[model samples]
Target: MSEAVKEAVAEPALVAIMEQLPKTEVPARSPLAHHTEVLSRPTHENPGVRLWENALRTHLALRGDAGSADFARGVEAATGLALPERLQCHQSGEWALSWVAPDEWLLTGPGDQALAMEMSLREELDGHYAVINLSGGQTMLRLSGPKARLVLMKSCPYDVHDRHFPVGKVVTTVLAKSQATIRRVGEEDWELVVRRSFADYVWRWLVDASQEYRLSLGHPE
Candidate 1:
């Protein structure tokens, strides 16, 4: 037998999987929990910019060979959604899988299901791949209203025009001074996934930028 083949048989990769969330119930708080007053206040009638938090949802960073049939099938088997093409996003029920890079995607679902989802992916996937639970390190925010596009224009250097950034398009770009995975969900609705540490900075930046547009804080649905 070839030495290369012998070496491959002698050594195997080790993968460690663990539950990222606490086993016991614990009070969960979002990055903006301390800004309750600011988020709960009223705004002008027919406010032009409405904001809210998706908060604490499970975020999984998935990496695999998009060109492989096994990779694609395994992802669909584990996620129940197709692998999104470049700069695209696919949603099935409460789960959304978005393409973040050539070989990377972001999968988000109910907050409590991070471990289950991660396990399922590990079970179905083979070969070199990675699934990381980022639920505790980042959060999602929703921004919608007539002036939402304008707000995005002020924040991101990327052209957010309707033609350039159609619905279901995902782009990781600069937001204020931090970076955000921005997705266009609807005509005027957008979702921003930011790091937990930068959540406050992004929120405050949006608030100040939307001042002239009459900002309103909406309850998450």
Candidate 2:
């Protein structure tokens, strides 16, 4: 399906985004930087998972009594993408459909387009349902490299072997001190998505665990 961005923003819109960016960035020497750098940390220590202090995108958590015909129809009409069929995802152009549960899903996109997306979703569904705009409640970490999968195996119980988790895999599972939606972005990269409150705790935990592997590549130049 297809949806359009409303493109409604005042001059100060960019200023707000700038103010929210995390003070620290992975330096040139860090593995995550342009060179042989590593991932950087936010200014503070988070709790459950790694959190980007300034959320660069928007997220919506939706819950509907989807067993009903009306709820399903409304949702399908609202987003070009169909609701995931039994924990599966459907993508139509710019949108993605992620199965959060039997009754819920997370609709996500650029921050500026959130309002338009919400309006479209609200128009389609009724009955005991909820759509909370979570633009500021979480963050993203795009993890990659030859050793990214190994790092995840050490952090969580979910199996990380290629035989078990192939490309296009997404699962919400546990990490040390927190839980996250670990997705395989590519053959070498993975994303360790964490919540806003738990960003610090997860960062520290990752660093400590990675130390044994000589993960000094992430240190600042």
Candidate 3:
């Protein structure tokens, strides 16, 4: 085989799929659209936990060899954020990367930037790696305030104590009756990545659980 042919054969056809938002000015309906009345309510004084849907953000499930130096370098080169270690998350600007498993990570960014980010990743990465756009399948919810940890403890069986959970940690665990990929984003803030179908149920459950300490809705950060 000629050198030119070998180079052509080595390059794989791009297979990454990106979900595009509507080009027109149509109003987007989130999973919690019907609950706007509840979410529109004003925040209570010193509420225990503040709730909001981080809806429509881009979510990408990245599968590759974490042990490979090339893989790590390519991901950072593409996303401007490092692939996190086991059960950890790293955020830079509008992008966040969370480790889901030994060889899997979740990359999230602005909803409109999904396609561009995926293309960048495809350009930088090679070999047995996969980049899947999961933006449509999932939505994120932010839970934060003074009593956020207490609310999480009430919902999940996992030990969410600061000593164990800590900042920058992520976990795939139970949230009330449904499952969620949970991450601690700050000393008092946590994020829940849940399926669109389960978003309403999870939101309702959190509202009920947080009532004792007072619950209020806020815009996603």
Q: Give the winner by lDDT.
A: 1
Ranking by TM-score: 1, 3, 2
- Model 3 scores worst on lDDT over the 10 consecutive residues at 14-23
Mark the regions of model 3 whose C-alpha exceeds 4 Å error after superposition.
1-16
**lDDT for each residue of candidate 3 in 1-221, tens digit (9 for 90 to 100):** 99999999889674636456767788767787788787656677677789988888999999999999999999999998888899999999889999999999999889989988988998899888999888888999999999999999999999999899989999999888899999999999999999998998999999889998888787643
Q: What is candidate 1's CA lDDT for residue 61?
A: 99
Tens-place lDDT digits, model 2, residues 1-221: 22333444322232112222234683212112232223443322222222122235657788987677788788789887667755355666656667778888877666567777777877777657777776566655655556567678888999989988876567888998699877665687566667867766776676666554444333222
Q: TM-scores, in order shown? A: 0.92, 0.66, 0.90
By lDDT, the candidates rank as 1, 3, 2
Q: List the pairs of residues colliding in candidate 1.
A: none
Stretches off by above 4 angstroms in model 1 are: 1-12, 23-25
Where does the lowest 10-residue lDDT sum fall in candidate 1? 14-23
Q: Which of candidates 1 and 3 is the stronger one according to TM-score?
A: 1
Which candidate gets the maximum TM-score versus the true structure? 1
lDDT for 179 in candidate 2 is 91
